[model samples]
Target: MVNITKDTEKEELIAQFWPQISRAAAGYENRPALSDELAQEMALSVWRSLEGFNDQCSLSTYIYRVIHNTAIDHIRRHSKISEDELDEAMLCESPTPEKNTLQAQRQKQLIVAVNQLPLSLRQVMLLKLEDLNNIEMSEVLGISEANVGVRLHRAKEQLSKLLAGMN
Candidate 1:
């Protein structure tokens, strides 16, 4: 556990990393607003775990991994989806918007489809969308750069299929 003694260095570290933590958390916005609460919890966990960090990865990468694991943990804890709930959720269709709506329905559908991707693929895609190169994504995801490329390819394929099916 990281001892947060009343030290300026510890305070500075926390301040520097908070935005990365929040950006990592933003990946979960498609889930319930509970994700924000979970993000806060994860940030606290990262702070507590900081002393043990050995600088194996960049600070940003480490924080992102922490946030990702925290979100997965939260989902596991709260996701008690029964068969009926799954069926109902699967049956729920995107709502049609009027012609004058600010955003196109297709765009909304695409967003929903992206949100439905499995966590690993979704995380990769989100990081890619944020313009991180494969090396950076590899660090953030604790995978090889080649694996990052493969996953991004598969994620794009899956998203394409999902969007096609939505139409």
Candidate 2:
């Protein structure tokens, strides 16, 4: 809720973008404590970077770029992600507890596999999970749309292999 500028407040930005920030952070670090710490760091980075934001890209795009950069910095500092399950509440509610349990297991497995990807492919997959179009991902990652497409394709292939080996 700290004031960033007369026009916009940090709290307002956090409220609007916290989900994306959290998801991006979790993509980098799975352990709950570390992921939460990364999310806070990303929010602070976004708050600090807000003043520099121009209309060159959408606010979502700007927010994503800041968070991803924060995540990369976090990875460099921390150097590893310990295995952990995602919060169950983050998963869809199934008709039964058994189905929900199974779904959660699969999701956890998928996340673990994703965490094993090379950084370049991991970045694209995480952005893709956030539903970014290739163009948006390109702008956020400062790569070409074609590169995004290639990475996404490779990520999907690799994830399939990783998940298969998990079973």
Candidate 3:
């Protein structure tokens, strides 16, 4: 296994995990512009926190914690401003010509549904999407493994209801 060293470039590390960072940010902020900004903030935060990464857990777990923490910060910073409610009609009935594929449309709908979930559930769902197991999620979230399982179960149930409503 290649070990991370001080000489490892931040650009390389960020590039490797950009997809995860972006996805986590998008889960927190439905607005693409704000999500992009959050992802950038996460990348910078990861670089700054790299020195503190003692290998107590997997590197991916550490990165997720950083990204999620940054997302929480973003939410707190913008808490005073009310976000526009997502229209249920817009979630499913958007017949935009550009997005022609059925799968793409469904994916977009799922993302919208996920974004509508409460923050606690949303965090678990997003990390679950990243393929993190309960233990890993608990470590990153600072919650118990049992709590992770409960949250994941709740997230799935809510997502199902949300998606069902869309159909």
Higher-ranked by TM-score: 1 or 3: 3
In the range 1-167, model 1's lDDT, one tens digit per residue, is 23444547556876777776665555554443554777687778777767766777776666666767776787677763454654455356455556237557665565566677887888888777667789989887789999999989999999999989977
Candidate 1 vs candidate 2, lDDT winner: 2
- The digit string of per-residue lDDT tens for model 2 on 20-50 reads 8888887888777789999999999998888
TM-score for all models, in order of appearance:
0.67, 0.85, 0.86
lDDT of 3: 0.84
Quote model 2's TM-score.
Answer: 0.85
Model 3, 16-102: lDDT tens digits are: 999999888877886656778988999999988877788888888888999999999999887522334445334445476757888
List the lowest-lDDT window of 10 residues for candidate 1: 26-35
Candidate 3 error regions (>4 Å): 1-8, 80-98
lDDT of each: 0.70, 0.84, 0.84
Estimate candidate 3's RMSD in Å.
3.4
Off by over 4 Å in 1: 1-20, 80-110, 164-167
Q: Give the 10-residue window scoring lowest on summed lDDT in candidate 3.
A: 80-89
Assess candidate 1 and give its TM-score to the true structure.
Answer: 0.67
